[model samples]
Target: MTVATDTPLVDTHFHLYTRDMPITSWAWHHPPEDASAEQFLALMDQHGVGYGVVAAASLYGQYNDYVIRCCRKYPRLRGTAFVRPDTDMYTLERMKADGIVGIRLFFRRVPDPPDLNSPEYKLLLRRVRDLDWHVHTLVSSPALPEVIRAVEEAGVKLVIDHFGKPDERLGVDCPGFKALLAAVERGRTWVKLSAGFRMPSREAARSYAQALLRVSGGERLMWGSDWPFAAFESGVTYGQTIADLHDWVPDAATRRLITADTPMRLYFGA
Candidate 1:
């Protein structure tokens, strides 16, 4: 099912990068081809989505030039970037002016990224806070709680990626999952309802969505397709992703809050 709202929908997460773009040596997976901005926008058009946030792919590391260019060229889109802890404030201000709204921190299966409490990170995160940008993170399990605490304590808004990337067997009881819920109940945390296709079980989507709705009551939640589907590209389709969301939430009005109101306000300043 496609998004049903006539109110222009907001895709809160997705990536746009060409195969020729520079990638980090440690990138877990590399795209075989481009997920160009034009292609992504066309999919949004087909599904009635009007605004989108390009999540900087961990594979591309800090090669944010392409994404920054796309955001500048297309006013309807905004982006997040991956940056070194020592990246300067002037560059960040320029990125923000170019429609880059936040930073993407990927800790999912990453053996070690960086210590947020380090002197370098402390300075970077402070700049993030002062600029009013959220830390869009992909972290799971044991690392999730620590990442959550560090980012929150630093006073930066946090947006959890992929249903908190919870372990299938633990369901909601996972310590990280528990911490995520607690974060929502207590702090400036938002969760994206996306990538259920990557969840261990299809039903996990409905269950996780219920858990978030109970606490957020729909305000701190947003929806995304995780478009191009990343490594799962071959198996999952864009329409199927939206249909999965329809099944998980079912209520059109609440879906509007996720697909329309919350994301539109957060990413687009609408």
Candidate 2:
């Protein structure tokens, strides 16, 4: 499908995985086929995306060697990895030097979320801040307020994944979503206009995106395909994923901001 925006697109979230990579845990019964860097780049080319950020898959835990390798291999690609609070500053500095622009915190499927208020977590955030990296989180809506408060208090730039993974039934009325809006107003947080299927209905997804547009405008919002779509891969197609942006963000100017300008600034520093 042809993208309507004049500006080049950048997918702010995608993943790369191979069978050879060890899996500590998985969101589903393992993907039927590998989603490799080579395939990701081909998809980008097919869809007119000039740049991408390869977010570390939680299934691989903290084994970021492959992603680091991809970043080094492709200048147009950047990455984020799953990291523990105890991860030392030296390693973080090394990762940043290797083109990792952010650190991901996955709280959605875990039994308990990290204690963001703890000293260890605070120290990690401080180190991340010092290195000029942002915190990318995939968290449930109910936990967003605390996470938002903690990230803001730590003075780290925040990127919320998949529309804060809001409850589709509640849409904008969800308390977690309300907190997301408030966080955007604070000026340090960026929300992805992505993973529309995560919401209950297409209408709900559009409502949430429109809510963000009205409150935060395009500056604090970006677009992502969630490529290879993990467990949902069978049902969703890359073309449809790119096409959804047109539906959710109808205005060309706003679409440009989300698809190109905002992402370039956030992930590529362009």
lDDT of 2 by residue, 1-270 (tens): 556554347888889989788887545447779999999899888777899898889888878999999998899899999888999988888888788999999886665568899998999999989988999998888889999999999999999988887865677998999999999998999999889976788888888889999997777999888988887988998778777888887888888888888888877778
Best by lDDT: 1
lDDT of each: 0.87, 0.86
RMSD of 2: 1.7
lDDT of 1 at 132: 92
The TM-scores, one per candidate, come to 0.95, 0.95
Q: Compute the lDDT of residue 214 as modeled in candidate 2.
A: 94
The regions of model 2 sitting more than 4 angstroms off are: 1-8, 26-29
The deviation in Å at residue 134 for candidate 1 is: 0.7
Q: After TM-score superposition, what is the CA distance of residue 129 in candidate 1 from its true location, in Å?
A: 0.7
Query: What clash pairs does model 2 have?
Result: none
For 1-270, candidate 1 gives per-residue lDDT tens digits of 555344338888899999988887888888877999999989889878889999999888779999999999999999999888888999999999999999988876455677887999989999999999999998767688899889988999999888898877898889989999999998599999999988888878889999998988887888889988888889898788778888777778888898888887778878
